[model samples]
Target chain A: MSTLIVIDQAPYGFWTGREALDMAFSLAAFDQPAAMLFTGAGVNWLRKGQRPDGVGQKSAEKNLSAAPLFGIEALIADEHACQQYGLTESTMLPGVELVSNIRDVLGDHKHVVFAG
Target chain B: MSASNLPERNNEGFLEYATDWSSDVASVIAAEEDVSLSDNHWEIIEFLRKFYNKHEMSPPSNRLFVKAVKDALGEEKGNSIYLMQLFPGTPAKTACKIAGLPRPTNCL
Candidate 1:
């Protein structure tokens, strides 16, 4: 079964969100199918040209960009969250699907995990 | 190998002085992990060294390590499973140790 990891926080403020991504990577390492949903402040993570060096945190962009390599091909961003952050598909990392109904997407996964 | 035979390292086996790291040191550490060094392994070790040189720190976690590898090497060799096959238990920890980089701080 696959796990849906929901990220709800902006990067660099805390390590929790990054840690959650780590868990996703770890699970993928063992051949687990995983997907990610970006919501709330998490949509900010999908924005392009993030320079997290100023905050002394590695940019999550690279990680998100590489998620497909880890079998995490399904990346969904909440439509409202994207609108709230003024982000469009062009502004987000390539291949992310922006969805208006997140509940339907959540229903498709057998397990769900939240990080904020 | 005993500590005396190895270069000075921190308690976790990371090099106390990164400059002291060499291919020989990496081989020794990999041997301890029962991993035979191949060109594939050397590629990652060299990559980690360059990453540390550039960033002044090892990739802080597996996610970052995967991303860094993907950025440097491309998608085929950068996936988590590919790395795990080369460095079984935890690719970031195992690779950083063999590369003589300091242990990544935020890794679980």
Candidate 2:
């Protein structure tokens, strides 16, 4: 069965979001079919030019890019959320799918998770 | 190079700044881990450093670390036993330490 992970929190503010990212990577690592959905402030994760160096954190932009190579089926972002966060097609990290109807994505997955 | 002359490290001995790393620093760290710097060890270390440069993070856990190695280097060097031999203890932790990268977050 496919798993859909949801992230609603902003990046770098909390470790839980990273744990969620790690959870998503773990699922992909095991060959469990999985996809990630970005919503709310979580869409900020899809934006490019993140430099967390001053915060002493690794760039989430770079980490998310590895998802596909590790076998994640897709990284989908809510278009409304992206608009709210000021992310455009050119501003987002490449390879992410910007979707207008996230409910359809929710309906398609057997297992859904809200990452902590 | 003496440990005293080494770049700053965290409590666990990983370099505080990745730019502080060099082959000499890797050797000093490896010496503490009881691993001599063989070409095979250097290969994995270099791969990890490049991986960090590209991804800006260490593989979060041991399983992902092996998967990443398999993805990049193929099955021969990617399997756990082969990596375990080259880097004793938790291979992810040990190798990251010597490679001058951050600790794998979920390794413990």
Candidate 3:
């Protein structure tokens, strides 16, 4: 079965907890097809140049950048959502595909999981 | 400050809002970057957590990052350049994310 994971929070310091990463990868490892969608606040997770200086942990951007290697490369972002968040295509990871909206991307998956 | 800015409370009544970076979180770790989070990565995560708990903020750049790690961990694990290379992201970024605290807006 194909799976779709939607990350709706910024992947940085705001909400880059282990639960988000764990779900995204566990679904991918099932041997079933899987993809991740970054929308709303989640779009911040993909922003480039995220240096977490003075923060206790490693960089959120770097950890997010590694998502594709785990086979969760299907990063779809909503164009409208990006604008709302004051972001552009250039700010995200290279493979991230911008779509018209959530429904358009959701239409393609067999199972969808929303990760906040 | 807005109530939203207030820290979350867990069942234990402690500020338990920090997200847990369990083994489950590791699955997606590789997709975000080329680097992998091995056992050593956990060590750094723990070290970073201690520093944050003590200082109530993220560590600065590599200079202070290494020092904090050494102070928290030990000289053997406190190799500055090695830590930097292993964790491409600044310690603050990684540590804060794992801790589940609000993202530090101050970092550039």
Highest TM-score model number: 2
The 10 consecutive residues of candidate 1 chain B with the worst lDDT sum are B52-61
Interface RMSD of 2: 2.0
> What TM-score does each prediction get for chain A alone?
0.95, 0.96, 0.83
Q: Can you write out model 1's per-residue Cα lDDT over B3-54, one digit (the tens) per residue?
A: 4688988777788877888888898888888899999999999998887665
- For residues A28-98, write the lDDT of model 2, one tens digit per residue: 65668889999999998888889998998888889898888778898999999998888999999998898
Candidate 3: Cα lDDT at A52: 66
Q: Which parts of model 2 have CA positions greater than 4 angstroms off?
A: A13-16, A28-33
- Winner of 1 and 2 under DockQ: 2
Docking level of model 3: incorrect
For each candidate, the alpha-carbon lDDT, in order, equals 0.83, 0.89, 0.59
* Residue B4 C-alpha lDDT in model 2: 90
Q: Name the candidate, 2 or 3, with the larger lDDT value.
A: 2
- Alpha carbon lDDT of residue B57, candidate 2? 79
Give every collision pair in model 2: none
Q: Write the per-residue lDDT of candidate 2 for residues B1-108, one digit (tens) a residue.
A: 988999999998999888889999999999999999899998999999999999987887788889899999999999999999999999999999998888887778
- TM-scores of all candidate predictions against the true structure: 0.65, 0.85, 0.49
Tens-place lDDT per residue, model 3, B1-108, is: 232343454432223444443433432433343456777876776665555544343442344455556665788777766676665665444444544433432334
Instruction: Tell me which of candidates 2 and 3 scores higher on DockQ.
Output: 2
Which is superior by TM-score, 1 or 3? 1
Predicted candidate 1 versus true structure: per-residue lDDT over A1-116, tens digit per residue: 68999999988787878888887776766667999999999898899888876876667886666577556758899999999999987888888888999999899999999985
